[model samples]
Target: MPALVYLLVLMVIPLGLVIAYAFLTSGRFGGVQGPATLDNITRLFQPLYLEVLASSVVNAGLATFIAFLIGFPAALAITRLSLSWQTVALIAVVMPFWTNFLIRTYAWILLLNREGILSDGLALIGLGPIEVLYTREAVILGLTYAYIPLMVLPIYASLQRLDSMLLEAACNLGAGPWRRFRTILLPLTMPGIITGCLFVFIPSLGNFVIPELLGGGNSQMIGNLIRDQFLKSRDWPFGSALSLLVLALLVIIVMLQASAARRSRKWGA
Candidate 1:
């Protein structure tokens, strides 16, 4: 009951305020002032904002794809290790959490900046210094790096729970590694993959710092747009509307993930 009350006070109440602000009129100065209206929500449909929303989705999708490509194998490898090594591997995966997120982002800036280690190393190798910082690629890299642990942990937990006998039996039946994984390992771990994708994709979609610092403030995702509206432009109503839209997107994604998990369980059963 205490926890519930705390959630209501911290999360629910704030969310209710944001929703109310979304409907209320913007003050001549900044915040809520006049009667409720749909104007703020309507403004989101304008071409400029629509494009920002689309790009945010695309960038997040690309980041999730990259994370999956890297994280799945890493998680699998960790599961294959000895118990102590497994602990170490997981610690490594989650070590970034020990650091401040902003500091980690700034570290990426030091690496990707023109005068940073990457460019200097490239120049030493006789390749010309390439444009990497302030690009979509940098933002994607940052997003992937920041969220890879989110991808790995869920999948690792799933893989760890898998029955070893299934693989051994498949091997005894003349199944190759690829066949065993494809037919047995992959099917069982579908829930984890779905969960990890949800974990990575939702946060990636709303990330602002990666785009702002790594993408040089040009690559504005939905979070960045919302921040600009509320603080920079002082368009509180519009910002509140965007926040609600993101919340709605999160709810929809969670529903889709839940559906996928149910289907996976049905198929596994």
Candidate 2:
């Protein structure tokens, strides 16, 4: 009853309002009315919205994949270290996240811009100075940098809890290093991989802050478009519809991830 009351007070009521609005045509004056029609849903399939959705998926997927690649190895390396070193490494991974998200993204702007530290440093090394900020590549890098620790946390936790004996046993049973990783470590750590992927993907897919600050108009993402519709354009109905699309996409991703976890569990067993 307590939990139910909290849900009613918080999530349920807010979601109900959103659902109610999504079905209506948003007035030009920024109001919603309900003689429910498929207008909003149909409009969602327009090429612009479709392109935004596709871009969100691609960018989020790239961030998730790259974070996993960096995290999995880092997680393993931390586990194989001395206790003091492991603690230090874990703290290092977490420290970046403890800073403000906006500040972190802004820091990336300084690092990746043509006149910024990184590009200029590369130029000093005789490499051509690259204009990187406000580009798609920079957006992806921003996302991957911001979220890598999220991927690392779950994976490192899982790796820490894993039995080292299984690895040794696999190696002794004539399994090569690659085979051991494939047969034992990867399967055991899949729950964390799934967890980390969901963590990075959901936020990246719906993110507005980093994209808006870093992407400029040329790299406009769905999140930025949604923000523009709601706040700048004051088209609540269209924004609500787009918001619903994001919610639906999140639900689908969660369901697919849950299904993947189940399959991995079965395969592991």
Local distance difference test, each candidate: 0.91, 0.87
Window of ten residues with lowest summed lDDT in model 1: 260-269
RMSD of each: 1.6, 1.8
**Highest lDDT scorer:** 1
Query: Candidates' TM-scores?
Result: 0.94, 0.94
Clash pairs detected, candidate 1: none
Tens-digit lDDT track of model 2 for 123-241: 99989498888888888888888889889989988888788999999999999999999999998998888999888988998888878778867677789988988888877777878
- Give the distance in Å from residue 133's predicted Cα in candidate 2 to where it truly belongs: 0.3
Tens digits of per-residue lDDT for model 1, 55-105: 999999999989988999999999999999999999999999999999999
* Model 2 lDDT, full chain set: 0.87
- State residue 154's C-alpha deviation in candidate 1, in Å: 0.6
Error of 2 at 46 (Å): 0.8
